[model samples]
Target: MRGDAETTRATGSPPALRRGACPTLAAPMQTGDGLLARLRPASGFFTAAAFLDLLDAAEAFGSGRLDITARGNLQIRGLRAESVAPLSAAVARAGIVPCEGIAVEVPPLAGLDPSEWADPRPLARKLAERIADSGLDLAPKLAVIVDGGGRLHLDGVAADIKLVAGAADPRPVWHLLVAGRPTGVSGSVDAMIEAAMSVVADIAAYGSAARARDLPAEPLPPGSSSLALREAAMSPVGRFDLGASVVLGVAPAFGQMAAHIVRPLILAAVAEGVSAVRLAPGRAILLVGPAGWNTSVLVSLAASLGFVVHAGDPALRIDACAGQAGCASGRIDTHAVASHLIAHAPALMDGSLDLHVSGCAKGCARPRVADLTLVAMSCDGRPGLSIVLGGRAGDSPVATKRLEDGPSAITALGQRVAETVEKGESAAACLQRLGPARIAAAFSAARFNGIDHAGL
Candidate 1:
């Protein structure tokens, strides 16, 4: 676990994965379920055959389990030190060139979307090239999200630097943001790239682990505006007619799918003559087809194959880490808990808030704060669930329940929220109105006169 530069020099063989470092084919991370490596295609997509071949490599060298990270990166879990080189060889043999250096991200529909003010891909490419050649040795996790006023833009995504293009009156206007704060620096694409690199160089001065958020506050004038942000679940997950082309977006349940489970998807894509497959944020897969091609057939197939084809799917709102089944650090079955909540807590999961079920305090699945967080732990040597209201996975819990008692407790809490919600009020609002004490009371199975649990 000590793969930092200092540690790697003392002990050879790269020691272990450095803390806060991004995993790569050359340097993988040690996790509870063995070594984990990540791969992001340089072209931001994969050929159907290449993707399938990569999956075969995953099954051969590691667990067949694959995760499409929330940020749209592919992760191969259950790797070993001995297998890393072979996995790299297999990936290279598959013609997969992994993206390297500072991440310059753009919308999945980059040049294809009619709604975009302009294509950010070219700008992103230029910025990426400059960053790569600068030899800055920036933080591995640094990201630059470029939004071109598209239907599926990355406004809400966290980034060290952000660039957003406005509609073209004559030419598109671009805005630059550094570390979530705007710099009055706005103009052409070249201007934004320079502004971003300047900020990146400043961050580099702080050392390898230093992020933009760690920079000292500097008051600056705000830019023209920001895009109206939408919830991550509202990410485009259905068919889209991009004027010149068509695309079908789909995701496996909870962003985790068996490598082989994609055989049918690949077969359908091939039949549809799909040109490319892109990884999308919100754990979506975008299948691009020829213009005017009928996407409904492929959409139907994806849904039938148990993929989340639309924004409204319940699986999109839940984030669960690999629990006892996959990871050694897990204390309980997180996926099972998610399934239980989905079956029993429909009234509370009204698409108003995110629910996180973490196997341990690390909160690796969804690092951000969620409306409701359940951290699985051991209570006096017995598996237990710790409820954290309006907090993160690692936060101190206000209520606790035995894992055996989780289903009943969750059902009771849902019933309470259902009864407490007023007409036109969201579950989130109701939870806030009820307060943490009342929410904890419901988890403790104290009464709210209950709502209809007739079906549950």
Candidate 2:
């Protein structure tokens, strides 16, 4: 929900989709192609058959375009006004009930990962129910995260209220975090729940527009452990050995998957004895295989089917929207440029920073500013790709290139960075050192090599 605002700004959404509104099924948002709907299955993980039914619903009603968002929600695009209700019905018929009320998020592999300190599902369920029944008119976008420490903690995910597990003394100690920052508050499970609800109640008094950042600091509870931030050691795009079984984490190229593409992948998982398909945060799909099933074949096949199977894959660092190829507002092919960067930009993809490729000014792919952002734009009637260094999609560009020349321009930028980067210095650091003027000069260096501007 923190990131959904950019999606609605792309163009005129449906009547129900007000500016900065989430495209929930009840209120499908209008987009360039048609209505767009975001869905999260109540039963987090979906059985192979159930997922196939969902895929059928997406293809039949929408334009076959679906995306596993950064927060792990499935959003279907190109839905028609008439097909919206049918799509909802089809989902219900498939037994895939959408999660309603305020979004109380937890890691996708909550119960499955044995490495987790404790499963957060029960507490999350309780918290969600408490908020719903409390008659508190909280903001529609309010989110609560119960982070039971695990291999896949909710590190980068944002929330109005976040409860991260601290020391597991008998029962786990929950460190209360408000808006991604710790609140100098840690307490017993029951105590933390009440604290979260109390905060929710406080926010409710402020009305629907209130975010966690809007409130002032709260007084700490007695014996509050200093709030700590825990990040995931491993990337979500890899194999997770769950002792009893294994879960293969695969990601669609650029987080967006065409239904035609996902169908075959789902069928392949079923063939490989994958019982359930769970959507993981960071735009990943978790294929939970049955115990002792041969998964080597599936892993290889998935790689061939345009899925990033390895943990260190560079494609994971890049976020791109459906550019000209899929969206009507696109000025260039964002995917093409991102694909080029993954294969070509070794200096840029050293895990130094994230690369955001936006189709237009509205950078729906990422809510925050990236280390480097490549935005597609147009000057007069000429299509161009703008390179924004350390800024959001809407930020002004340092350099511009012809739409067709975007891939090569990015390649040139990478080559430029590679040549000048100091030893042990990250691409981000080097860019920061060089400043925007130098970076822009490098990005446009290739195009002006021998061109005669005076002749034109």
Candidate 3:
């Protein structure tokens, strides 16, 4: 299939199997809002001019809302059937090409980081070319990561195959990891690629539903070695000193921003000497520039434009879907409720708290398990929010409450939670202290009597 042809539906209608396929620029998936198309930059980086042009195309052809996905791809939401072709063409004209074949991801600072164990770009390029020409049928979501062992590592991101740089015990080596588990080590890029290709080909032959972890364990590739690799500790957020220059990581609230906010932010970054904007894992935009660039000013500007500059920001603790405003399947205003909960009780952001406010059971925003998950559901034929503890969105709820009572009730619950934690207790310790029975009783009491209390 041609690269541009993948951007739209041939019949200009919604795809029949929306959930089964990956939504690319050529074939957008039908969502509650409208058609949603995702674009992956060829080089994992975008220029300010190219980004602004793409933003303009989104505003002109689709809804004026853009989302930066967890994998660092750009998604244009709310597109009409007819708009896909034009949007795809405009994007191509702006030099933005969607990635093809099994996606191979690298860190945002792939080649520029001088302190890296090895530059993974050359190997990444060779792997991409091989995958494109291999003709091996692979699953759409099958992916690989090439981590060069820089401060910004890809250890946290999930991938089918991982090629991570190993420590130089005399010489630098690359460890071939499958499903986050290291299998063997290679001293050269070619050897690593050969091993990875063999594994990918084996996976392709195992049928579409098969994954790397599903395959049986096998012996390491010939002429390869084994080494114990340790995951590097790093934060993709915050400022990083890149030798003589600096890079600032800026995150948008919920990894999304209005199209209007995007343009001004890009223009401001360009004006402030930002040459290229790279999207990093964890949904951060890295602004690269000279050594003495005014990062504080740029950070202030980004904050004013509704961007999250601090890693400790309360908004980072809450993961919410588009909710009623953007998704038709949403039963409640998840963002509103999340904001209210954060503002009413600030203790939720104290430490390592995983809070997810999903619009529906589909859980597009966060599919992973969280400490506190609120899933939209129907109660007594009325829209409600199901409270799930230490589970995912699709998990059975421990309790349910009316959506109308969500704001005040959740606020009260947050207060109770805060008070429980204020007694010099950890979040986990507080949860253990306030058992499920007592917590459910408080939620029920808050919903029934509409009273605010700090006791559970």
Candidate 4:
């Protein structure tokens, strides 16, 4: 019996959600408003017109709010019951192709980077289309990534299949995983997709609790599940800075963008020759500007985007999922609470504190490791969050553990974590120097009643 199954049985719950229609796209029309249609961008590239369409759709059909998912996809809020059909048509007309390769993510600057091994964009598109048209039902959330000789790869970020470049092989090799653990390797993209689809369907059929991490650690069933892999063509592009968002950054507040203030600032940057804009995870946008935009102007742009850009802005590390409005499972509007904390509690937070608040235990909004995490769990008529601290992200990622039990306790603990990080130094310096044990100690100190420091 797999651990997932054992856990599900213990809880007397249905199998972990795998193949049901996504809430964002579960309507007859299958669009963004109902929370079922997640429009995944190939390599995070979208046309300006498409971007505008998304903005308009978000404002009109859905809640006038936007979310940049941890998977690097754009999300629209405030969807009604019957908006899926029109939303899907509008998306298709805007030239945003919904292909099977929707999960094939590339580095933010694949073409722009000079020293990459191979540009993985074209190959990604080819594989994505084949999977879309293959007629095999797959988990709509199934995803993969191709590392084109870049320094970055999805080390800990969850994915069903990942195709990484080999040192000597002309054809890129595929590395398959069950959860986040490696399961097997293959040379064929088509075969990899087949294996991936098999895993998806098997889980769906048996009501099994298998994920990419739960596949049997034996050789994959061999058959016609392979395809010839090839390298993507390279282009000698000129030096241009394709602006990318700072990794592991969260919004100053609970992912809110005051419309009237931020829209003109974004448009002005476009006027000043920004090629395109990206809605970054953790609720920020990356403006890929021309080579010569003024540095002061860029900073001003970020400031206008609702960020407090300064030397020691402690609010940069906090993030929250759309708690009440966007998700039905949410018990509290954590975004509202997060906003209050970010504004009034800067003295309670220091630069080193990376806080994530999820409305439910699914932990969707904050995927990457953080210094402190506040996940919502229900208790009686009231709702609260679990506070965990001392996580980090790198080649090897470490997730934090719970330190406090409810929202009030978590907020109280966060102030201490912030103060400890600000122990007579700058935010950057404190973050670089602080270790997990010390941060954990701060959280433990805030534990109410008779909780011992067993884990710490």
* TM-score of each prediction: 0.91, 0.92, 0.91, 0.63
Give one digit per residue, the lDDT tens place, for model 3 in 75-124: 89989988888887898888877786667899888877777788888888
Worst 10 residues of 2 by lDDT: 447-456
lDDT of 2 by residue, 182-247 (tens): 788778778888999989988887777787878887677667687455564467887788878788
All candidates' lDDT scores? 0.81, 0.81, 0.78, 0.51
Residue-level lDDT for 311 in candidate 4: 30
User: Model 2 clash pairs?
Assistant: 13-30, 14-30
Specify the poorest-scoring 10-residue window by lDDT in model 4.
392-401
- The deviation in Å at residue 69 for candidate 4 is 0.5
Candidate 2 residues lying further than 4 Å off, grouped into runs, are 1-15, 219-223, 227-233, 448-456
Residue-level lDDT tens digits of model 1 in 1-456: 223333444543334556677888767898899888889988878888888888899999998888888899999999877777778779989888888767788888888898788998888889889888898868889888887867788877889888888755788978887788876667888777888788888998999877898888677666555544443423768878887888888998878878888777877787888867888888888888888888777878888888888788787889988877778898877877888788888987888988999989989889889999988866568777888987889898888876666667788889998998999999999998999988888887733234432211
Which has the higher TM-score value, candidate number 2 or candidate number 3? 2
Write one digit per residue (lDDT tens) for candidate 4, span 179-215.
5544545545666566555555554453333345444
* Per-residue lDDT of 317 in model 3: 71
* Candidate 3 wrongly placed segments (more than 4 Å): 3-10, 13-19, 169-171, 217-233, 422-425, 432-435, 448-456
Separate clash counts for every candidate:
0, 2, 4, 20
Q: What is the C-alpha RMSD of each candidate to the true structure, in Å?
A: 4.2, 4.9, 3.5, 10.6
